[model samples]
Target: MEILIMLAILSTVLGGWGGLNQTQMRKVLAYSSIAHMGWTVIIALINPNLMILSLMIYIMTTLTLFMTLNLSSTTKIKSISNLWNKSTPMTMIIFLTLLSLGGLPPLTGFMPKWLILQELIINNNPTMAIVMALSALLSLFFYMRIIYVSSLTMFPTNNNLKHHWFFTQTKTTNMI
Candidate 1:
């Protein structure tokens, strides 16, 4: 149990810090998964029943985020910059989904973390709870960067290509 807890903490810290310098969206997601997995593992160590709950939430949040990235065929951070220009709604989805992925308040993603933190405190493990919360904050920094890129960036008129990614999005396709 001790070893597993350490691994979980290590994963959370590494994932939080590793993504700070990443350029590829996939890599960032991968790190996010690592951190999330750590959270799951930590819950398993302390409260085995909650592990399933955490995993389920992680899967849901990750799936939505990946779907949005897929919508834009997003690869590099630069690729995300033009997503808003093409589809405003998709861009909005990406923004909200990313926030949820970061475990901000009032999102599906925050539910599990909140439960886990509460569990930890109930178990008399405030230190672990603090670390987990801090790691979430660290991860949020990178998510905000992605959100900023997607929301504010646009294709420069002087692009080497004559036409930018053809604006296939005639109308903001209503999200299902």
Candidate 2:
């Protein structure tokens, strides 16, 4: 249990640091994985019996969604900004992933939280459960911020003045 806790702590710190430091979109998602896995590890310490199942479900869903995102033309926020005009499917998936990460209902994310909360309640660890649940609200803020940026705004006129090389490549390749 102690080992798991320590590893979780280490993973979260490393992942958070990496996510914040890098500009590459893939690395950011990689870091997000580290941080999220950290949470699963920590939670597992409190609820050992259910940890494996929770982790399995979380990892599967996250990786699957990320794979879809990776195959997508849009990777970074800057690229995502230009996406409103490109493909609606890409835009919608990003929005859905954001919502899933925020643990909205009917998504895979809701399952883990539901299980975690149930475990917490069963363990009679109401305080920890409440704290964890409330802390989720903070995560929601960041997710909502991303969603708002991706889905709500029109592209800046000034951005049009800059020609993205990648866009040219994509166009050229598609033509061939």
lDDT, candidate 2, 1-176, per-residue tens: 66775686667566655554454557656766776676687677787667777777767767766776676655675566667565656667777776676577887777777788788688786765665565554454555666675555647555455543335558779889
Candidate 2's TM-score: 0.67
Off by over 4 Å in 2: 1-31, 46-49, 156-176
RMSD of each: 5.3, 7.5
- If scored against the real structure, what TM-score would every candidate get? 0.84, 0.67
Clashes of each: 0, 0
Predictions in order: lDDT: 0.84, 0.65
lDDT of 1 by residue, 1-176 (tens): 89988899999999999998898989999999899889989998878788897887778778887888886798888877676666667777777888888898898888889999999999999999999999999898899988776556666545454344455454565342
Best by TM-score: 1
